[model samples]
Structure formats: C-alpha cells, structure tokens
Target: MTVKPADRDFDALFADPSTRARAARGVSIRLSGLTRRFGELEVLRGIDLDIAAGRFVAIVGRSGCGKSTLLRLLSGLDRPSGGELAFGAGEDDDVVPRLMFQEPRLLPWARVVDNVAVGLGRDRDAPDGRLRVASALAAVGLAEKAEAWPAVLSGGQKQRVALARALVSRPRFLALDEPLGALDALTRIGMQSLLERVWLAQGFTAVLVTHDVGEAIALADRVVMIEEGRVALDVAVDLPRPRRRGSAEAARLEAEILRHLVHEEPPDVGWVI
Candidate 1:
C-alpha cells in the first residue's frame, strides 16, 4: 500500500522494539521516560527532549553516550526499546527527510548524480526526481561533478555529495551524525559554513551529534550535553550566524561549554572535557 503524504489517509502506529508501524507526524518530538540497554550495558536512561519546529539543536557527549543510537532511533534506522519518538507535520508537508552520516556513502559504480538520487524517485526523467538531484547538487556547489564518479572525489567532496543526497528530499528534519568529523580541521570549517548556509535557506529542523564542543557551539543554536545516558546540560548560543571560532567571545563560550561537558558531568557527556 502506498502512503500518501497527508493526514486523514494516514494513522500512526507505535510498536515497542520490534514491530513496524506508520511513523508519527508534526514537529513535536517526545521521548518520554526512555531507556536503552545493550545486553548488560545501559546506554540511555530517562531522556526527555521536546524540540519545537524550526529549531536547530546539537547533542554533544563523550564516546559511548548513545548519541549515535539516539540519532538512529530518530532517523528510523533503529527501534527504541522503551521510549517513543514522534514528530509533528504541518499542512502540505514537504519531502521526507534523509539522514547524512560520517561516511558519504555514494555508490562507487554510479555517477555523482545517480548516487545522490539513490533513494529518490525511481525514474531519472521524473520532474521531481531530476529537479531534486540537480538542486541538491547545486546547493552544495557540486553541479559540475554531476557526471563524476565517487572514487574520483576527495574526502571533503565525497562528504559534500553525501550532504547533497540528504538534502535532495528537502527533509524537514536534518539529522547530522558526525558527518564532518572525518574531515581535516580546515575542511571541517568550510563544510560547516556550507551547512549553515543550507540550513538558513531551507529552514529545516536540524539535530547534530558532535564530539567537538567547538563544532557544537559554532554550528548549533542550542547545544545539549548528554551525560550518563541523559541530557545533562542544554546551552543556547546567543551569538548570531557566521560565528568565528577564533573570536575571544566565541572562544570563551566554547571553553565554558567544554568545561561543563567534562568535569561537571558523568561518563555520558561530561566524561571528556
């Protein structure tokens, strides 16, 4: 059965851990009394987050804090054993969101355009499909590489192509799972600017998971520190866009965020400062 993109015709279902069901709608996301355990290891405990539409949030925590797991759950890549995640939708919701990861994940055999269109409409000539691939590549300044193969592109370029794929659908919610961590420091900054520009233009809700405090402060409007499998600290970056990491004010803010992340928190978020 084909699910049309609208209300009334769709009824959401919730299955704990295993069964598949229709996904939830709206910008509102609820994680009520959530907990996750891997055999004997508990990764998350009683985490609650309510992010409104159009908000840009970041999750930063030490390694093994379950940030990736949380991202997977939200992206429909994994099932939550305890909590339920639900998003709200407005009238005439746009295309479904796509998840971008640390790896570019392009098809080695396909051209750049085809790789970006992997999950898009089946027909290459379809208006929406063609337009989306072109626009996504153009947005990332990669229209010239439309015919190139992924093997020929550099690490940064490959990441950009991955970014294009994620944006091709114009997802209302963009979940970035350490997509920039693999790049060198210099390339990382450039990609950050490109991401910022795209977010401003598209106005989608973005949730970024980063290990770098400086990256979080530079990229997110609000940064939340996940500790002991829970969100322990949430800080809002009052500075405007085009933030410079070298500026004294920005540096101070980053230091403060780092301090809060490492010493004051537990093994989840603050364990590493």
Candidate 2:
C-alpha cells in the first residue's frame, strides 16, 4: 500500500483517543425519486442515490448535466421539486452541510483569521471561536498566515482559507463544487492531497462535483456520472488508497469513464469497475 501525505498527518492527529472521539462522523445521504425544476427546465429528472457515511463520492458529467444541481440539493442550497431527500443514521437537524466553491470567496477586508471565523456564524464571538478558527487554519497548514490578508495569499492559499472556513464549522457533510478547479495543475494536485487528509481526519461525508473523470477516480470511493439529468453510470473504485494518477488501473478507469462522457461506443466498455 502506498502511503499518502494524509496518512502521516492522520496518524499524528488522531493518536489521542479523546481527540479522535471528538471528530465528526459522516452523515449518510439518501435521495429517492428526487426531481428539480426551474420553470420549464428540469435539471434533475429523478435521482436515486444512497451515499454511505464517511464515503467520498464524486459526481461527474458534461456541462449542464445537473452535476452541480445535484450537489446543491445535497448541500441543502436548493430543494427538490419532487421526491424525497433525507440524511440518515448518526445525523440530526443540527448537522449543517458545508459547501466549498470554485472561487475562494473570502472577504477582502477581513484578515485570514476573521475570514475563517465567519464560518461560525452567530458563534464567532463565542469564547472558543478564536481557538476553533486557529485550529481550522492549522489543519489546512495555514497557521502562519492567520494574521495575513486574503489579498496577500496565493490562489492555492486562498482556497486553503476557504477550506478552513468550511471545516471550522465541523460539518458532517461537505459538498465540493469544483473547489480546486481554479488552481494551477501542481497546486490542484497538492490541494487534492490536503483535502483527502482533512476528510480522513474529520471523517466527513464528501460529495465532489467535477468535470474531470481522472480526478473523480483518484479521490472518490465511487464515481457517479450524470447524464440527461439521471445517473447513467455508477462505479466503485476498488483500487488501494493513495491512488496513483498515472498508474495502469487509474488510466483504465479514466478511459472507461471518458467513453461514457463522450458517448463513445467502445465494444468492450462496461461499468463493472
């Protein structure tokens, strides 16, 4: 098994039993016959999905394929026009799902610490608010930049701050809307490792929406491709963790997914993996 950057960090962070117990357990999600419509346009016809707790699931599809729309529904940013959407097992009404977008969307005037503290909403002024903010920043490896302004940070650093803001709330379910799509190639890869590590440490259920099939296979336990407003393909990634991007297995899975996305009729292509 390959050792991921996250593995070392996870071992160090969860060494203490008490600290490990405090980590949030992911909330399972169930969507049955879910439908969403914007006037005459139906973005999602009927999405039926069951995401296990703590599982990293990726949604992939072409543009306007309702991938982001489904994510929005999962994050509770939008409601389904018809059908049922439920969060189950180990979750309650108090669990608020967090969302990270393509852009950092930080407050330009606020300092980094203050920007992260905003995630706490009403509790930001609480006695432990600053401490929580500090911890979140440290988790994203941005402890030294806490006092700096958003304008001073690089693109990747800005995204880190955004991630810190989302994590500061200790959310059980995280919806990532192409959070690394704006970063450069190398920076995006680094951010992916950071994200995997954070998700492991926090034990949050993550749903990522992206156009990259390779990214989906690399990061998610399962890849779901949406087409014509429905799930056209759903396949598990059984490869060992700390998945190698250019490995034979990775390339094979990517090729399989690409065939679907492009509507190619490869004779042997199937959704078995």
What is the C-alpha local distance difference test score of each model?
0.74, 0.83
Give residue 222's lDDT in candidate 1 (0 to 100): 89
Can you tell me which runs of candidate 2 are displaced by over 4 Å?
1-24, 90-93, 264-273
**Per-prediction TM-score:** 0.82, 0.88
Query: Of the candidates shown, which would achieve the greatest TM-score relative to the real structure?
Result: 2
Among all candidates shown, the one with the greatest lDDT: 2
Tens-digit lDDT track of model 2 for 39-135: 9999999999999877899999877889899999888888889999888663364668899988999999999999999988778778988888987
lDDT of 1 by residue, 84-137 (tens): 666774345443556889888888999999988985634456677877787677
